[model samples]
Target: MDAVNLEEQAARQQLFTTLYQKVFPAVAKYVSKCGGSFDEAKDVFQDALISYYEKSHTADVTINSSEGAYIYGTARYLWIKRYKQGSQTKQLDDSSAYSIIAETEAAPSEDKLLHFLETAGKRCMELLRSFYYDNLPMTRVAQLFGFSGVRSATVQKYKCIEKVRDTVKQKALTYEDFLE
Candidate 1:
């Protein structure tokens, strides 16, 4: 009813639209790939989105990666949390269980990747971040990044990945640097 409330509502709508167009479907796919169903994926993504939004609203909240990357990371965290809470305590595969636990507890790597992307073109960095790091749906990402559709986004994402991969490879040319 109030002007401030209306503005906030509009902002919320914009956020939802941006997320719906940029976030959801990719996360759903990742969830499904990791042995979750569509319904489960939806639930997980919804919780992740809520957490992301809350974090976003906080002062000086700087996302070192694309919004998609942030969402994916959050979704993965929420999914792991849900799994821990669920009664499926029986181990399915021991190695997988270990890897999953390791990944879930690892520290964030956004800032490091972001610094790499910064030297790359802004558009390329955005595309790479959304697709590879964030795991956003190609369909929506294509539209957001000015591609024709999902197909283009997919191809572009592949190319961008290659670029990043190449960059990493080049940087790692010396084995001594990587040695502890």
Candidate 2:
């Protein structure tokens, strides 16, 4: 079951990667013309791809535009939608809106990934919790993890971080929170 899930993830990644390579240059150029950031371009692209996939799955649907055009058009529409939403944001303070947007963007993926690792990656959870939550020093963590020294323990810790961070990043792009 887990292996099946992993394969699904791999295939999805390949599809998205191929689509990105094929479609991104045009989308990126168009988005920049409309004053969008790189991250905004990415968000628009993902939403466009999901929209395309959903549309394709419906019976008897016909797209007048080519796939790349559909994606670009959808992304342009999403960018406009995002701009409208941004304009309506209440002026609490300059920084407040940014903080709120940042939280809205980050919290779901970070929380869910942490929750997942807490279950599936016991060693990772333990190491992260000890280092971060428990405020354990590097030397102590090395002793606890039996890494012989701080340098070795630090290296292992960073490797664990990279693995979890990569998972979090990729899962974030899937709009996993949108499903819930």
Candidate 3:
């Protein structure tokens, strides 16, 4: 049993080493292009590897792409999330920024939008919220919504968006009148 465990550990280590070599450079380049530092790239890449490992080990989740591609994609997503959070924090800390942002907006009230969406039906609201607001991947959204696959979830998302669009058009409201 110890021998088997040692072999498994060795194999996992080799796999990760190979993945880091093959994947890290591209992830680093992407992060750099997105204005992240090398340390941030490395941190996000490590997080991506952990995410990939967890998802791969899950019985219901399947990675459809090459391992490097999956890791790179995950790293990109992590970096974007981190960057957005950082920017939002910075924005919140700058007091004068709020007034400038407020001056630029003329849109339907959140209450009105929520009421319209609520009228669109519960399932549409949940589906839109999961995909857009929660930023869930299509596969996870599919699983959560009991969809057969990603394609179905994607189609359903389009349909829900169209439903909202149609409602907006029926009311003779321009898209900009919604929200920015």
Better model by TM-score, 2 or 3?
A: 3
For TM-score, the strongest prediction is: 3
> Which runs in model 1 stand beyond 4 Å of their true positions?
87-180
**lDDT over C-alpha atoms for residue 100 of model 1:** 82
lDDT tens readout by residue for model 3, 1-180 = 699999988988998999999999999999999888999999999999999988988999999999999999999989999999897786444667776687577555787788778766899999999988999999999999999999999999898888877888788986556664
| Candidate lDDT values, in order | 0.79, 0.82, 0.89
lDDT of 2 by residue, 1-180 (tens): 699999988987887788889998888888899888888888889999999878976888988888888898898888898889998975788799788887676545565656756643788789988998899999999999999899998988888788766775777755546233
Candidate 1 TM-score to native: 0.46
Please provide, for model 1 over 1-180, each residue's C-alpha lDDT reduced to its tens digit, 9 standing for 90 to 100: 999999999999998788967888888888888788999998988888887888888897876777788888999888887877775776569898888887677645666666556656677888877876788877879889888878888888777767766876878744333222
Q: Predictions ranked by TM-score, top down?
A: 3, 1, 2
What C-alpha lDDT does candidate 2 achieve relative to the native structure? Answer: 0.82
